[model samples]
Target: MLMELIFNLGLLLIIVILLILLSWVWPPDSPWAPRWRTKKETARAAFKLARLGKKDTVYELGSGEAIALMVAASEFKAKGVGIEIEPFRFFLSKITVWRKGLNKEIKFVRGNFYKEDLSGATVLYLYLVPQTLNRLIPKFRKELKKGTRIVSYKYEISLPLEKEDKKNELRLYII
Candidate 1:
């Protein structure tokens, strides 16, 4: 019994170490990866853009771990959809939404955001690099309905005619 216990403990320790190493080495390639932990002000700004009426449907592109989506779903009482490419983050988001009892209000999609339809969304949130935004500009213009609100963190795209709101560490645009 003692030998078995020692072996189990040793295996657990090794697994923990490996997980830590992997987390550091293979950090998620999120545009807001460094800011995985949401700040109060950022969350407030995102919520503001959501304008979250009960009828509003909000979509978050590249929603790493779905933290922002969870908050939006709970605070605004709006339906939230999140698309995440990373499998690990996707699973984590699924668990979080389930544990928060937000499964009904929050949905997590494990796939690329560019392929998803945005016509149904009234509000959109993104924290992606400038290049990614440029690539998605055409898609947004084509799919998003007029007057749909878009809130981007730390980056902005060149749109022909769009409104911009510049707050500390954030930017908002309406299309």
Candidate 2:
């Protein structure tokens, strides 16, 4: 009985340590973390609100799993670029896009969203924390061309609001 108890304790300790390490590298609550997935329904709503359509270049900042980009490419007939900083998420998104045979329509970029050029983007889709949104204010001003459509899920941008989907909790702005 004592041996079994000790083995159980050791197993529990190992699991706890592993969890700590995982959380340290992938903190779910961190503003910069890219684990949160914007649902497909939400993506569709946001894309529709943004008026995304054929030939439109959409950039999804912190695009987890690249689901939004896939939706844009498949449903809205738009081209997309998904930027992800997290290594594992980036790899997963890259492979997923390739496996889904969307390499022609969607591109997965592994880098900082701020560093990625926005000049070519006609639309922006963001599902990020408020802190990240706040930090991007200047980047948006500097990089995004006038008339670029921005759709932010669950957070408001400082730009003038052009449209909103209250049910989906999304906001849209033009730069």
Candidate 3:
């Protein structure tokens, strides 16, 4: 009985390690490859720059691991929708949110952010490249409501800059 228990424990450890390894490796081969999730401190600073509040619903593009959304929900008490194209990453995001008891505040959609309807979002948080940001400008202009806020990490969006946290490499804009 003791040997069987040890084997089962070892099997569980192996499975946990496998999941961790898979989570660290980029699963997508497209432009979203080498997923760079915004660091926790950086995400907090970006959300603060955007002035995210409890009433806001922040939508994140290429939300690998949904780190920003998790921070927004847990730290700022805001709701969020994470758009992740990779299925494995999306699954991990869902699990993370669930484990953190933020499932009620965060939702994950395994789809292209460009194709998703972001009309309901009051704030947009993205850490995409400049080219992708430029491509999404048209969609942002069309779907996002007037006075909508945006918090971009590293790259600046085309919208008028409202605030900037240069130390954190974050930019805020209003649509």
Candidate 4:
């Protein structure tokens, strides 16, 4: 009994150590980076962009947990596509969308958002880092149609023709 207990404890300790290492190495690739919780003000701002019109299709980059996407689908009746890089978070987001019965209006894709096409989107929502946003702006300018709206939390693009509106922790850009 003593030998068995020691073996079980050692296995449990190994598992715990592995999990901790994975958590550090694979920390969710969310644009929010250090922060995972979505502030109410930021969510509201993203919702406002989605609520622009019923005909709008919104693409949320690095959509961790799909909170904003679910909200957009539920409240504005907008179609939402979310891209997430982390496997665990993407699975959690998928489960949430399924449980919420938003499968029809909201879809979550597990991959890098930078590689995905955003041309079909009428509105784009981002909570990514400045470097990511900088890399995406050129693509947005090239592919996004005129009048396309982008809502970003805590970052802005220095486009020559983009309009900026600051409210709370969010920024709105219209191309």
What are the per-model C-alpha RMSD values against the true structure?
4.1, 4.1, 5.6, 3.7
Across 63-160, the per-residue lDDT of candidate 4 in tens digits comes to 88878777677777889999888787788889989998999998888898878888888888877767778889889988898888888776765655
lDDT per residue as tens, model 1, 1-175: 9999999999999998876666654423453243354554676677775465677788988888777777677777788899888787788889988998999998888888988888988888777778888899999989999988787777776765244446645566677
TM-score of 3: 0.81
Model 3, residue 34: C-alpha shift (Å): 4.2
The TM-scores, one per candidate, come to 0.77, 0.84, 0.81, 0.78
| Model 3 Cα lDDT, one tens digit per residue, 1-175 | 9999999999999998776666556433243354466789998998888888999999998888888999999999999999988887888889989999999999888999889999999999888878889999999989999999988888877778888888988888898
Candidate 3 backbone collisions, by pair: none
After superposition, candidate 1 runs with Cα above 4 Å error = 1-37, 160-165
Clashes counted in candidate 4 amount to: 0
Where model 2 places Cα greater than 4 Å from the true spot, the runs are 1-35
lDDT per residue as tens, model 2, 102-146: 889998778888788878899999887678788898999999989
Candidate 3 wrongly placed segments (more than 4 Å): 1-35
TM-score of 1: 0.77
- Kindly state the number of residue pairs that clash in model 3: 0
